[model samples]
Target chain A: MKIRESSALILPPYFFLTVFFILPVLIILILSFTHNRDWSQGITLKNYLLILDPLYLKVLIRSLIFAVLATLGSLLIGLPMAYYISFSNPKRKILLTLLVLVPFWTNFLVRIFAWFTILGRQGLINSFLLWSGIINEPLQLLHTSGAVVLGLVYGEIPFMILPIIAAMDRMDISLLEAATNLGANRFMVFKKLVLPLASPGIIAGSIFVFIPALGSFVVPDILGGRDSFMIGNTIKNQFMTVRDWSFGSSLSIILMVLVLLGVSAYLRQGRDQSMTLGEYL
Target chain B: MSHRDATSNVGFGQGKSVSIVTISGLVFLYLPIFILIVYSFNDSRFSASWNGFSFKWYKIMWHDGPLWTAIKNTLIIATANTLVSTFLGTLAALALSRHRYRFMGVYHKILHMPIVIPDVVQAVSLLMLFAFFHFTLGLVSVILAHASFSISFVALVVMAKLSNLDRRLEEAAMDLGANRFQVLTQVILPNIWPGILAGGLLAFTLSIDDFVITFFTSGVGSTTLPLKIYSMIKFGITPEINAISTVLVLFSTLAVSSIHLFDREKK
Candidate 1:
């Protein structure tokens, strides 16, 4: 009776996940290696090797450049915002926090489209400049790398802010006082006391921003000109236009590997920082 | 007294830091969005400048069929995804929290992977997986894809509530000869129902806002609102897009905030 009841409790979710989620993922993994170009060629390593080519390497570098810039931008902006909210009056904190999240509730595509109105040549910024007698022609702000980064940082700022706020809220306020009492100046207190304490939050926020930015498709596709194609756009094109599922699978596997490496490296650095700090202090 | 003194010193400089930070943060966060909203009303046909405010774009948005269809489809998918994910997610949470899970570590990690995995990769992987299995991209694929991610989020949030719950009440009920089902329904459900509701609302919002996964899994005819907006933006910008976006932003803010308001009301 006990055994029967136990199984019944676990059965539904387990069965649901296994059938719909696990099986599909496993099927994709299995098909990734099979070289069924003509449905009879069987399994091979050609797809994997194809991914290691110079062309893909360039694409991989391009994605890293975009993601890194966006992550840095989010950090520069999000850190201070998080600090404000974390240190603010408890009553007003909730309202400010809601500001970060409210934008996220709207569809991402709509938000990106909104950027079009602002950044496009005939859009607001250029028009404002033209009207102000600054320039006779509209500035070519749209369909550029800058626009791609702007869209990415805009979309991901909340993701970066939330984690940093969580970290900041948990910080030991006494440490800041200790640093100040020890004759540390304001900049010294921030650099030595607050930055170290917030490293974990920064790390977490960076991961949250970096990973998504790396694989973001819509921003790059819409805002980026032909020169701004990331690996994400490549994979998207493969399946949608090239009609090549196998090649897309290979790209997915490579992206997964790169993401894992990046995350692991980030965690390692975080771990090392804490370890060295522990040793020094 | 020592702790209080230390806290006061830290609090002293915090105000100046906060005011400076708040203004900068607001500019960083809202400048782009503000530019977009202002340009939506511009009379100028091509640029982001304030040519003049007009309701012409709003009228155009009303006449657009694709936009309406996308919104309708997104609503349907969000509703369906919420219901299905909430049911499965709540059950998963219950199983994790109420029982001593054996493979708990593995289960938790697997569920969290969707959130951690880049959406672009997941999009491609799902598309490849669907094609491999000969599953066609349509409403069904998108629904399943959304539910898969939503379940994890729902489970995580519900689990947070469950962990904070006192087990003594459930233990007492069980000790009084109540069956497990009766105890779960009468004892646990009422206490955790608020969190479950909040989780369900979040799932709905996520489903509605999702674009990347839906973009890949949705067939040509089954355009969700985000996908429709994506296609439209590639060609050109219009005022109707702005009007639709303004309405979308307002609706989502109301939807998400209401969940928090409801939660606060209980407390």
Candidate 2:
């Protein structure tokens, strides 16, 4: 009786996901191997082969590089802040954590757009420099690889911070004291004790930041120049502008596989921590 | 506990530099938003320059018909998606948490797939599905797509809550002659109400803020706020966009903060 009741309860979402979510992805997998203009031409490796060209390969490499840099940038900025918050009093901890989340609450597009006014040729930074007589000409700050990295790092830092803070909250502080009492300096203590203990958080946070950065379209679209085009841009163009669904589907599949690898790493780390999937998010 | 204090003191000794990093991190996070809000009141049309204070952009946004249409569409979709996904997800969570069954592990993994998949992949696949099925790309398709991904999130939240639930309450209610339906409605539902509410708010926020999936699934007339903003930003930055974005930012902040506060209170 209990089993039947449970099945009844689960059936709705099971059916919903199978129909709308799982089935769609399966269709995309099938579609990627077929001809774009005419499906009747049957399955072929053309779409996947096309993605192997050096031009497309460069975009894929650029995406990976950008994602790695963004992940590292977020870690550099987030670790200290999360460390501070972890040691804060309860009242201050909540407040500081909320501060981290405030930017995330804003529309992602708006946050990226804010960079435009700050980085454009005639924008805030340039105008201020020119007014202070620091430079005779407005520097090109927008539409560059550096600008894209900055935007991505800014956008993803909170994800990195939150998990690290959660991990730190659960840490055994006595281990830190033992390290200190044994005459290990702060840097040595962090390297030997804190860093090893927080590896799970670091891995989880990296997956969170890196996967999104890899698949990000809007950030690059807004802040990146032509030379900074990532695989996401290539995929977007394939679908929207080029009107090649087969090629787009193939690109999407490749990206999905990469994301799944990151997610599996996250899941493994999560298993060690006994964390629910929701907690990782 | 004394050892903990000793370690925390070590942390406190570095407080000066830590505070600097924290303060600067806060500034980095908010500077763009602060600039955007301040520049929304500028009399200039271009966002980069500030002539003087004015509410011209606000007035312009007030009269922007397409913007209003997008807002309406977004709210309608978000509301519908939230209601449907939350209901379905809560049911699934109850099933997963309250009962043990064969293939339960596989079921859990399947449910988590949507949460991990990239939005672009999900978007393109949904677009393909719609084309394959001859489903018109419109408000309905967008709502379906949003709900499809959002159900997983809702289930996850509710499952987390349900896992910690005291099953004794339901058993006690049943011992007091309550039927299964009454035990569920009176005992389980009230217990998990906060999770349901949080999941609903999350779904609504995600549906409202969704861009990638909506971009592909939305038809010519069913643009959402994010979609509208994307098209506008693609052209160029304007004070009008700043004003609209300020409103969106304010709304989302309120929504997300309320969820945070709600969860805190439950804890």
For DockQ, the strongest prediction is: 2
In the predicted model 1, the residue pairs found to clash are A122-B46, A122-B47, A122-B48, A123-B47, A123-B48, A124-B48, A124-B49
TM-score per prediction, in order, is 0.90, 0.94
lDDT (tens digit, per residue) of candidate 1 on A1-281: 11123555556766777766666666556656767344477787777787679888787888899999999999888887787777666656788888887786777887777776677776667878988999998888988889999899988888788877776666777777677788988778767777778777788788878988998898898888887889889888877898666676677777877887877677577554422110100
Off by over 4 Å in 1: A1-5, A128-136, A178-182, A262-281, B1-18, B48-51
lDDT of 2 by residue, B166-211 (tens): 8788778888999878988999999888788878878988898788
Question: Could you report the DockQ of all the candidates, in the order they appear?
Answer: 0.44, 0.60
Cα lDDT tens digits for candidate 1, B1-267: 234334433662356765686788777666666666665676766553357788777778888888788888898899999999999889888876677556776776667666667787777667766776789888888988888778878888888887778888887888899988998899889998977887898888888888889988999667998887777776765666677777777787897688669767977
- What is the per-residue lDDT of model 2 for residues A1-281, given as tens digits with 9 covering 90 to 100? 24244667888999999999989999989888989847789889999999889999999999999999999999988888888887776667778887888777678888898887688776789989999999999998888999999999988888899888877777888777777889988778777877777777777787779988999888898899899988888888998899998899899999999989878766775575745657644
Supply the DockQ value of model 2: 0.60
Q: Tell me, what's the RMSD of every candidate?
A: 4.5, 2.4
- Root mean square deviation (Cα) for candidate 2: 2.4
Error of 2 at B184 (Å): 2.1
